[model samples]
Target: MIKLKRNDKIGLVFFLAFIISMSLVWLFEERFDQEQWRSNPGKRYKMAKNIIEQDLLDNKSKEEVIQILGEPVTAEFSDNNILIYQLGTPPSFFDEEPQELIIVLKDSKVIHVSVNQEE
Candidate 1:
């Protein structure tokens, strides 16, 4: 076997560490993003409103949402046929527009969820 220079050995260790650390982060990153997404109710509302107003329902499946909401309003086809379901209508205050909860779905499952806020 050929001998590696000291710096080369260090670089190899760093590269391996980076690969391993990033792999772990990638595995747990979803939980981190979802943690706050669930605690904040206002965010969930806005997300739902966006799904309906902006026509992002295509990102999720209708049947999946039906299981959650028990029905749907109207929606077009999703690019990958994933199911997106907004949980609740926005809570309005001071006669302002109501914020809604946004639910993101993938492969007929709820993957990401959040809410929208009005300023």
Candidate 2:
């Protein structure tokens, strides 16, 4: 076996630690769940990434969206062809605004989906 210098050993340990920690994070990352979404609003941010990446809401009908995500936070936004589901405040050290899952619709079908901070 090759012997590493002290500094090289330290660097190797740190690199291995980073790889392990990142793997743990990926393993624990949340996936979208309808029940969890309706029950735990605060955890929506964890699942939002999955939804967008999978295009889960894309091209779905308005009623289908409601069935999947429950009702929008308010009806006022619906008039403008947008559905907003409050995702609660994201986990952050900085003062971050609450986020929302914005689903845009056209002709009563979903056209786009995104997670955006509430203004």
Candidate 3:
């Protein structure tokens, strides 16, 4: 049997630890849930990735978007057709800026959706 050197063994342990930590993080990640999204504002960031990637709001009417995501934080302005939904601050070791779900509307229909830091 081939024996590993002390440094090699230490490196292997560190690598295994890293892999295990990443696996745990992935397994515990939150998925998109309509009820959860509506009820849990602080956890919205956990599911925002899924909503954006799936294009759930693509081409949806403003009213339909309200029904799905509830009333936006900002009122509809005549100058700009955009909606902002607060996603709250993500859980982190360091203080991070709160996030927002920005939905751009054109002709009363959703055209773009993105998550960005609060300004």
Candidate 1 or 3, higher TM-score?
Answer: 3
Order the candidates by TM-score, highest first: 2, 3, 1
Alpha carbon lDDT of residue 50, candidate 2? 93
RMSD of each: 10.5, 3.2, 3.8
Against the hidden reference, what TM-scores do the models get? 0.34, 0.76, 0.72
Which segments of model 1 are wrong by more than 4 Å? 31-63, 68-119
lDDT of 2 by residue, 10-78 (tens): 999999999999999889988889999999988798889999998999899989999999989964453
Q: Which prediction has more favorable TM-score, 2 or 3?
A: 2
For residues 1-119, could you state the per-residue lDDT of candidate 3 as single tens digits?
A: 98999999999999999999999988987778889989998889998898888899999998999899998889557755999999999977886999999999998898999999998
Count of clashes, each model: 21, 0, 0
lDDT of 1 by residue, 44-85 (tens): 543353444444434445464554344332233655333333
Candidate 3: lDDT of 48?
88
- Residue pairs of candidate 2 with colliding backbone atoms: none
Model 3, C-alpha of 45: deviation from truth (Å): 0.7
**What lDDT is reached at residue 32 by model 2?**
88
Score residue 24 of candidate 1 by CA lDDT: 95
